[model samples]
Target: MSGPFVYVPPVNPVNYPPSPVHYHNSPYLASFYTDPNSPFIPPLSLSGNASPYQSPNTLNSPLPTVLTPNAVPFPASSSGSAFAPENPWNRERRVSWNGSVAAPTVPNSSWLQPPMYHYRRRSDAAAFPFQQPVDWTSLSPYAPYRTELVQQSFIHPLLNAEDRRNDLILDMSCPSFAPMRNIGNNQTAPITPEELNQLAFYPQAYGAHIYCELIPDLPIDIRYRPLPGYSPIAPPLKVGDILAAIWNDMQLGISQEMWASLDENRELMISRAYTKRCKIWASRGFPSMRNAGVKKVDCLLGKVFFRGLVPTGDEANTLRMIVA
Candidate 1:
């Protein structure tokens, strides 16, 4: 059942179009009344309907020359459709003005959705795209041995002589006068707070001389010279042997040493010349002597037990361990 066509005046005449002008048309457009009591309605026919001005049996009266427009082609039949379109984004069932029937809820069930993204360790990057290799910058070959480092002293030690002498000679002629021939822990005094805090020292070897070395933790390319009497290619002790022997017990046994007898006397003397060139802990321990500076190693010529050098005159108490 449709309403009859009528010449209902546009409440706003300007909006209807001036006089007899034609207008654009779409299948989606609808006609409506502004006043509730108005009796006229536009013809229901599209451009298919004949114009009232041009023919008999046409739309009646005042709006006789209605602004009928030419229709555009429709995509589909307009049956069972509304003037307004269904929302393209309307994903769920919804109610309409006419009926209870609504669009079935879009099947949001798992069967209709895309499959779950499965992940596995694959050679392809897509599997673990964000994954990365181990951060080797944070790694090291000597990582395990790094625990040996201790807290360093911030304060400086009091001025002290770098080289000290001890009368380490034993006199067989005056037997009873000098009963003590062998040096022991009792000969050394207890450590003072200053020595422990300001100096880096091993308490066991504080007064006694034990072989010490400060090998650089980094790999170095060094062209070195062997001892005066030893051959350059086949020295008495090699880099590996020295490192192993020094670390074995710190103090190597005198009677147990199997060494080639060569310049024995000159080798025993850890003279001032050797001390100045060696890497004494006090020298290398300083920040100024590290990294960019040239570094030397403290080498032991003979075993820690072997003796030829000793303090002269009154320098007995401060018999500093001379490193050759």
Candidate 2:
């Protein structure tokens, strides 16, 4: 279904009246020269130009001129005697429509006063209608309110649980936050090195790569490379923990940088080991181990060790030499 449509009318230009004329009271100011009560005496040249005893009726004012047709519509003002030079004969002529209207009249009210069409606003000065006080106790605290409060007294317990859940599941889907297996209060026998060495043999035919070159003195050959598993011990160990263990055992002196390089190659092996471990545990109806995230596993052999080493694909010979 379609939504409702609205039609709006266009507006027209409004008409306004011409502005009232404004008279500058300068004309009467010049008359002060003849009055003795004036604080400023007129200059001699100005006094000489001024006429002595001219009757008000003898004054001849020029016809009011239009300064601006639409905007001002009024002539500038001058002293009553200023017209003397223009009308030297002093004949009082009716320039305005009515002789009595020669001077402009001031309006009783301002032009900006509200128009007659405008309704005057009657303010309600009295206080707002009294409202009865609410009995808040009668209303449940859990009642829904659209307004949010800052530092409100009541906190919803669900909010904390939601925050914890958000921290766990980034995409809000599966049980990503499950704890690691054998990590809780339960205790189990630790894996031994003998078992690890036994498990290191690859039953699936790729195992030959793992044995150390039994003939390191033999010039390195092609096709029989070391099938280096992620680590000497199975079950992914933290690269640091493994290096520390090696240092503690005092078997070989390998630097952290060498270990770092080994881990890079070790990642694929580590992933495979974890996959195998997970399958075994699952088949036994045991809980799966949680991923501790991919860790860097470095090699003990320095780059110098493999300087001229090449692959030699003689499995029977290599296995005999390696097993020896």
Best by lDDT: 1
lDDT of each: 0.27, 0.26
Query: lDDT at 215 for candidate 1?
Result: 18
Query: Candidate 1, residues 154-183: lDDT per residue as tens digits?
Result: 111111123133323211111011112123
Off by over 4 Å in 2: 1-259, 263-266, 291-324
Give per-residue lDDT, candidate 1, residue 31: 17
Q: Write the per-residue lDDT of candidate 2 for residues 1-324, one digit (tens) a residue.
A: 987976533423211111111212121112111211011111224343365343222245334335422232123324433222343445697765644555654334434333334334336524545644455434432333344554312111111122222111111001121111121223212222222222211121221221234223221111212233323332321212211221222112233564365455564554564455445445544453333222111121221111111224465212211110
The runs of at least 3 residues in candidate 1 whose Cα sits more than 4 Å from the true structure, single-residue gaps closed, are 1-189, 193-251, 255-258, 261-324
Candidate 1 TM-score over all chains jointly = 0.14
